[model samples]
Target: MMPAKYYLFTDGSVNPQSKVGFGAFLLISDLAISLPEAKKLVETVSFENTSSSKLELQTLLWVLAKLDAVATEVIVYTDSQNIIGLPGRRIRFEKNNYISKNGKQIANAQLYQEFYKLTDRIQCSFVKIKGHKRSLDKDGIDRFFTLVDRASRNALRNS
Candidate 1:
């Protein structure tokens, strides 16, 4: 039998000092009638060499890992289009297969590989939502993209 579907909203924030924080809210499809009904999750980390894109990718990987252990089918909502588009693009795959002239691995290759592995273990899809936006759902619940965004930033600040 197929497992139930879940929805996850994720966001990541990075400061100028390379401190990174990620936030995600998960809800079983049946309970996702409002933003307040979702559960909040957050974490913080730091990278010596970091970019917002890297933080975003890490955030996706982190949330997916958590979801994989619980749900068989998950639809992830994120603001980072790059994460959503990675699997559909060929350039990154090709780069990961070949080493650069300087003999270094392609940036984010490991994360992409981990993402692929996790995706294989569970049925998952990604949706791109606009960052820092406030909108109302059909059920009149305020969409929590802005909430997740603030949560991530708060995680960074508190860390």
Candidate 2:
């Protein structure tokens, strides 16, 4: 028998200093994925990195790791379009430098590269949302993301 269909709500935030964080609230109702399974999948991914942007991307990738080979549909919501846009375009990271087709060096190559890899897995679509919105759903997501964001920033600052 088929497992089940699941909808994933994900959000990420990053400070200018390159600190990044990602949070995912999986909706595991009868129409969504199983919470226990999803949580287990998320636990398998590590968040040790130099930047929060990478953390955010890692969170999304973590979601992919949880899916059990069942054809589950995932919808990811994020506030960081700059990072999410990496895979949508023709971009590459070489020698820790983000290089364009013209060999122009882009900033945050590591984050982009990780996001690039995260974007390669599973059936997922990213939607950019306005951060700190007053809506309840958006606000709750913001709270979690803020924690991840601050944690990332503090870690980077201390390092």
Instruction: Assess each prediction's global lDDT (C-alpha) against the native.
Output: 0.65, 0.50
Residue 106 CA displacement from its true place in model 2, Å: 6.1
Single out the weakest 10-residue window by summed lDDT for candidate 1: 133-142
Query: Highest lDDT, which number?
Result: 1
TM-scores for candidates 1 onward, in order: 0.74, 0.51
lDDT of 2 by residue, 1-159 (tens): 744555555543344454333344444324333434544433222343335455566666566665636535655656666645755553335443567667666655654565555446545666665666554664544443333344434544444
* CA lDDT, candidate 2, residue 91: 37
Candidate 2 deviant stretches above 4 angstroms: 1-4, 12-24, 27-46, 91-121, 136-159
lDDT of 2: 0.50
- Per-candidate count of clashing residue pairs (backbone under 3 Å): 0, 4
- In the range 1-37, model 1's lDDT, one tens digit per residue, is 4346876666777776654445444444654455554
Model 1 scores a C-alpha lDDT of: 0.65
